[model samples]
Target: MSTEYKGPLSVETRKIAKDELREDDNSRAQALRQMRDWIEKNPKIISCRTDDSFLLRFLRFKKFSVPMAQEAMERYILLRQTVKIAFHNLDHTLPKMAHLIDNGYLFAVPGRDKLGRRWIIGRPGVFDPYKFINEDMCRVHGIVYETLMEDEENQVRGFVHYADGAGVSLPYLTLFTPKEAVRIVKNGERTLPMRHKEVHVINVPSSLKYVLDWGMTLISDKIKKRVKIYTTAEEAANNLDVSMLPKEYGGTIPMSEMIESFKKELVASRQQLMDNDNMEVRLELFSVQAKEGAVSALKSGNQSCNPYKTDVLTGSFRKLEVD
Candidate 1:
């Protein structure tokens, strides 16, 4: 909202980040491909880009429709508030306004000495962000990100953390991918045990129908099998089957049953994907929200709402300028 954040995703910052990343020889082609596709598909984004003051207008739009956008952005600033703390994606330093995604690196510091729990820290090349990427170490990585809000007393340190399972990192190319493609090619799929059964459907069957269909809509038939893309529940109720539904099918063909079966398939597929996925690969920028919306809603009213409560959320420290 302030002028300082006029456009967190501006060209200058992106240019700078890209150049730095190149120094490490990382391939940004994947991200560029996805960004193009996303912009091309979302007319709103295209129109926003045409304006010289796109950043300001975009923030306002988000404030109106989603107050959280501002919060997320602010949190990002705090996340990198100081050089004392920083985020890392692999060995490459995180870039400004970088969308969090699966495979996106996270850096933090867990308190040391007595406060240190049973887990390990500072193992060289062991996804151990605490040892490096800290306020004191960020400079060594060629990153001068914000300084610790106040590191005069180095008591503030990192905690366990990682990108949201939904985090995404835009390869330098700024490519955009449809949600479905993201779950597939970029994130990959997981197959079920072929035995897990008994699913229950409670939401709008029509909506579920739509999401599952994305697999077939964007995917050509040739490689669909490898991706496990399909219509309706095969052995289950077959919601994808309009041909077999009776004249009274819409009102009669046990639509509820189909939803249940389809749910089973989806749950298992994602579980398979989850098993193979690196916690980072499962998250993307806005992916925390992007990934948790549905699951949260389901558990919101239930007793299992705290998704990351027990999961190891690694924490890291950065230098800041807090008053």
Candidate 2:
């Protein structure tokens, strides 16, 4: 089959898609058409981009299963409507958001890794938990994730996270309640279309080891197995290429330059981020009977529990599995 529709895919990535995702020109075109038709028929989805690029993210993530992709699209829309803190007001020009970007709290590195996965480095330790709440951090993460999703390469190859935990103190750890942590994990695994490959945590203090152990309980088993903890940056460098990393970790490029470039990218994509707010779930569009059915479906499908309700503090942390 002619694979011209697979635009700009490297030979390795093209092979990965063909072998692993069961993708080809014929299947890709068919899946895109099916998804667009499904979106047009669904009343709850008020607006969405039905373009090939936008629809393909869900298609590839679900391995070309139209039904699964449809369900994932619904969950993605519902997440935006319900999670106002993270989804709403995604303007990069906002003072708080700009401040976060300027400080380089979280951003994707410019290039892909050896396996073609994108690298996202987060320096949460640099931010003040007292000044910015956990929700603020979530908003920043949401923006970065949304921005990264625009790239076809990232969607195809997946992502790796390097979490610099050098400066995280007890206060920073306290910012995340058990329920909040659970919600974050659920959203990443269920709502988002991105594939998470690995998470490398470096520079963790001995005092904070227990906190890391507790966090391990909340993630899904697949992600739990992917998590690798390293005592120093040198150890992590052995796994991740230093050339793609900033000079702070012995890379060639200076960290300041990388931060500046990332900030510029966010500013350039500000309008696109703002446009996401237009696509939402409009329950009012449905009839009374339809509305009730829709509400029931949303409640049943939602993986996140009530934010206000705290998880019971049994001696052990709650284990939330990924689907």
Candidate 3:
């Protein structure tokens, strides 16, 4: 369930979306007040600023369940602390990130899909492991964060992703391991607020399928059900609106134009990304220490997670379900 509002939503649409998420301006304001008060009263368990917007983002993601949202917020803080490569020191000025943006390696295309979900496309081939370290995963998070911010105020239904692994060369394949793939996918699925409508993977060579399948094992069955693999771009195009895709994928828009447009978005959002990177999530605020090895793992850029230990919310109100 997503709305196609590109800008300030109509009052009716906003109300519906908020109700669907079990929040309204007044309800959200009250919840934020209560959460902030709780945080101040019990500063040890969690540390959060009174950033209403930040709190509300998570609240919306959790359907305004104060307890659930609080837990999610805390988990997000720990995730950031634990996954340094994808969360630490992100800035738009990074040369590698800039190159990725310019080369169409990672980008969200302008406009929505036929169903109104946003379209985010990534080309792993555009990444040069020699120049771009695996730690650049943090930069990918930064880009995704900016994309979320872009549509935060609007009523968004969900997201649809297109991942092209056709460019996976033998050397590139060697550097890209299943472990790192699991790390990236886990961070995204567990932490991000967006509902992924589906993921269509195009140009999947036999060599890359094993890594892709292994990574899928790490994600929830719900997400796994939404993933579709096509041996060629043409077959994938049949399942999506070609008019909304770029020419490279048999769409109307040219690849050069898409890249240039995406570059502008990156430039426009650069400062915001830099600010978010430095924003504090004080995991040590709790009397107990941060995760035992999180600090060291983060420092050495060796982020990993026990896929089975992830938090799974259970209830009738859970908006996104596996089936």
Worst 10 residues of 2 by lDDT: 314-323
Q: Counting only residues 3 or more apart in sequence or on different chains, how many pairs clash (N, Cα, C under 3 Å) in candidate 1?
A: 78
- After superposition of all CA atoms, the RMSD between model 2 and the true structure is 6.3
**Top TM-score prediction, candidate number:** 2
Q: What is the C-alpha lDDT profile of model 2 across 102-202, one tens digit per residue?
A: 77788877767688887888988878877888788878888888888877777789998888987776666555655456566666876789988888889
- Give the whole-model CA lDDT for all candidates, comma-separated: 0.25, 0.76, 0.64
Residue runs of model 1 more than 4 Å from their true location after superposition: 1-67, 82-303, 306-323
* 1 versus 3: better TM-score goes to: 3
Per-residue alpha-carbon lDDT of model 1 for 41-69, expressed as tens digits?
Answer: 54222121222122222222132222333
Model 3: residue 319 alpha-carbon error in angstroms: 43
Query: Candidate 2, 186: how far from true, in Å?
Result: 1.5
Better of 2 and 3 by TM-score: 2
lDDT (Cα, 0-100) at 95 in candidate 3: 76
RMSD of each: 24.1, 6.3, 9.4
Measured against the true structure, the TM-scores of the candidates, in listed sequence, are 0.18, 0.84, 0.77
Worst 10 residues of 3 by lDDT: 308-317
What lDDT does candidate 3 reach at residue 39?
64
